[model samples]
Target: MDTEMYIEKDIYVECLNDIGMLEIENDEFFMSPYIRGQRVIHKVLPMHIMQTIFYYTLTLGEFNCNEESVLKTWDSRNEDRFSLEMVCKRWCSIIKASCRSLVLSLNNLEANTFRITHFTYLKKLEIINNVNNDSDYSDYDTSDDEDTKDYSNNDLYYDYFDQRKNITYRRRKRVPNKNSDKLARCLSTTIQLSLPNLSTLNLSMSNLKERHIETIKSALASNKNIKKINLDGCPIGDQGVVFLSEILESNNTIRQLDLQSCGSINGLEYLGRAISNNNTLEKLIWSYNQSNYTSVICLSNGLRNNHSQIKSLILRACDIEGWGALSLSDTLAINKSLRELDLGSNQLGDAGAIALASKINSHPSLSILDLSSNLISTEGIDKILLSIQSNKTLTNLNLSRNQLDLSIPLENLTSSLELNKNLISLNLSECDLQNFHFKQISIALQSNKKLKKLNLSKNNFTIIEPFITIIQSNKNLKSIYISKHKFKSNELFILLNHIFKLNDSIKLDNGEVVNIDIPSIVHQLEYIDLSQSHDPLTKNIILLLREFRKVNNITKIKI
Candidate 1:
């Protein structure tokens, strides 16, 4: 044991000497606490950016904007736009020189910009209004435009998913606009002076009825760097649209324009003329103007000769009809750039459907086609389905609420889907489905793998619920809405509880085996609605989901 211990001590001394941990001076050993040439932990900052951020954090106070406090500051500054550089003078100077965005609207524009000259890095400037969104709405009676549906942060769970498609995805929110025309007109020149390096400008109108449209015309004409502009819920009248038409005719750098829910305007004819001729724009989203046939025809004429840069065109619920659809079809046959087109709830009938189908072979860029609520019959459905067999670009097709006969159209649909193979999502809710239809769809799904979503709501499922027992599994169903259907208790139990395997391997703290059948990781159903089903089945479904949520991270389960 002594010899072994002496050998171990000799090895430890050798290792320490090799690592420079044992200082050798005159044959006497001295142990160093820390190894030489080792890097010390960085105490203050490793990178230059960390030091700069730390300095700014210590200098600048928290950015809190209470209405009364901000208004008080605004009044105190006598409308001089308070320097957004709220840090120390050094940090403020750095940010003023480097900041790419400067937003000044309402009373915030009171700051004079004559003292500053070199704002070369500024890129995006937004000037809306000063109305307190949360407090003002509750106290004052607002219009429908102010009451715009806020679907922000909420999951996309709408039958009408495209309602907020255009501007909602822009990472910007709705700011209440004021009808104070005097304030708007006064701020027009201030808009020009502040936006020197601006690339995108958002001007949400205060009151659609009384918003100063002249300010928009002035701002659009004055800026050269503004490439994108969003005018959400702007109540643009005939005169306002005429001004926009003139500005769009001359503007070359502007690429994206969103005038969603701008129906308060009556002059779509002018806007259509401008849209036809503009070559710089890549995306145009215009909705709720309720234009008539003349305006629709004019818009079609504009798109026919458009340069291939235009990629997306969304015009939803614009009261377009058969003639309107026919005109747009003529343009689609030739237009090369348009990829996404939404014409839902336009009442485009058999003639419109035929015109659109004939052009799909010519235009391969057309991917998303929404013809829901267009009064299309079996003949129209057959025409559209036949187009898919020849064309390969189509992905999402919504033909919901068109009163299609499931018995007649189901055969053609499955065959076309088999041939197409690329279509991902299809909505066929309220189509008067049958038992045989469900059975055939199950058989079709056995072979097809690309088709994902199937919305079977408002179908005659009570009569046909038993037939879907053959549907053993669907791996890609992201969402399924089966509310208001009389599903049998056994059918519900089998479909939900029995399809998935539970983890019986789990045990209790008391060393007992806990075996309760609930959701495990083997389920793929992300969203399901069993609301208003048979009472006994609904109770079981609820109990199952209460435990299901505990186990799985399902997004939503509607009761």
Candidate 2:
């Protein structure tokens, strides 16, 4: 069985010597007494089912599993957890005691931050003390600066054929001395002597203050099982949100709080009464804080009449208006545990979209409502599609870039998107849509069987035949975005080889025994973004998205 699924256990080399997972000083950690007593063992593949099939094939996934992090499979990754830490010292202490997360970096932490504080099966600790706004240090700082290399430049490797070029890497700015005080003394001695099964602490845009959040909320509020804390765009002020609202009112085990783009989100009325006497906060993103309208009615009067256990409230582009829409529609009719409300790109005109379309169908566990871009026309798009036409737990509705003059009440917003039917993802992107508003939303999605993801991306759109005849008359349209148009590089190079020969004549004239969920001849197009067009149609749309993504694997072509 692949030679005992590459056996290399010795009680994970005593959990990598009780924790200091060989943090250097190597001769490959003295390859453990030459395979110490290995008698070609494999008594019918036991060892905890081959160590749970070797950690399910070295997965770097499942951190809220939204896979396809821009698909860089690199030949299905799992280099057997880096060739079992280079095939030595009992497979390098069984791949360093299956370590769990450690994204540290105050740039070469004064010689391996005390052996990265002996990983002792760490849980999740991302300290990144700033590196030109680190996104995991701009995705693993890809080398090659050799003091501005010039190796007689082979014209910088032909600049990737110059047409849709993407070769960037110029990082050379390390000046962070005179006190991050050696990263707050190695984060006050690695949060007071190594991660005791730490739960998750991102510390984003890391230059976090208030004595590193009072020495990280007094060592994560005495291990109160810190659940999540991002501190995004961190330069946290208002006394770091009043010492993180007094550690979220004496930690009831924090749930998730991002505080994105925090240009000092000064006392959002002490983070809305410390999130109304918090009870395990369940997401409070507070996006791009550039607040107006009395700083969103002093943060929507601490999210009006709140009875904690908060449930998702994004607040994108926080420029909310006119009494930030009567204090966010009276805090959405007395916040009964909100269930996702984005408030996208907030310009929120038309009296803040008619004060949240007159109390948005009294939030029945509001299932995702984004009000995108917010130019909200057609007199607040007919009171936000007549309050999402009897919204029964809205399933994603983002009236995108609301320049929405949806052609002056395009049949009452296509009869409220063909009578809502509990929306299933809709985003009318840059909504000034035409061709008679795409044939009145393709005749209200012909007896609309719940919208299956649609976004009519930026409308410089020159009628791509009524969006491919409304995606060939939507039989539950899977996904669409009609990219940013302005074509003409020889008519988008003959409409990119006639849409890859019409997706190889509908996957070889629907042969291969049909049934791939035949929603109208095996419904294709699971996703398509075609980024920003005309760079000479980027090498024929990257050779028709690498030969139509090898004839199907949920067709996702985003140039």
Write down the lDDT of every candidate, Cα atoms only.
0.61, 0.63
Let me know the TM-score candidate 2 reaches against the reference structure: 0.32
Candidate 1: give the clashing pairs: 79-110, 80-110, 80-111, 81-111, 100-123, 177-206, 178-206, 263-288, 276-302, 531-559
lDDT of 1 by residue, 1-559 (tens): 1111121334555655686655455533342222111111122225455335533433343335332232211122332222223212333454455545555545554454332234455665556566555221233322356346454543422222247554332222333444345455655564466555667767664443224666657676666778887777766666767877788888877888877776544466786688776888887777666878888887777787745367788777888888888988888987888888888877798788878888875577888888888888777877887788777787888877777654455446666766777778877777666556656565666566677666767766754333233234455556667676666654555455433343434333345543434433233556776577754544545566677677766546675
Leading candidate by TM-score: 1
Best by lDDT: 2
User: Mind giving the per-residue lDDT tens digits that candidate 2 earns over 305-421?
Assistant: 445777887888877665676787888887777888898887778788888878876578888888887777777867877788787788887877777554465446678788888
Model 1, total clashes = 10
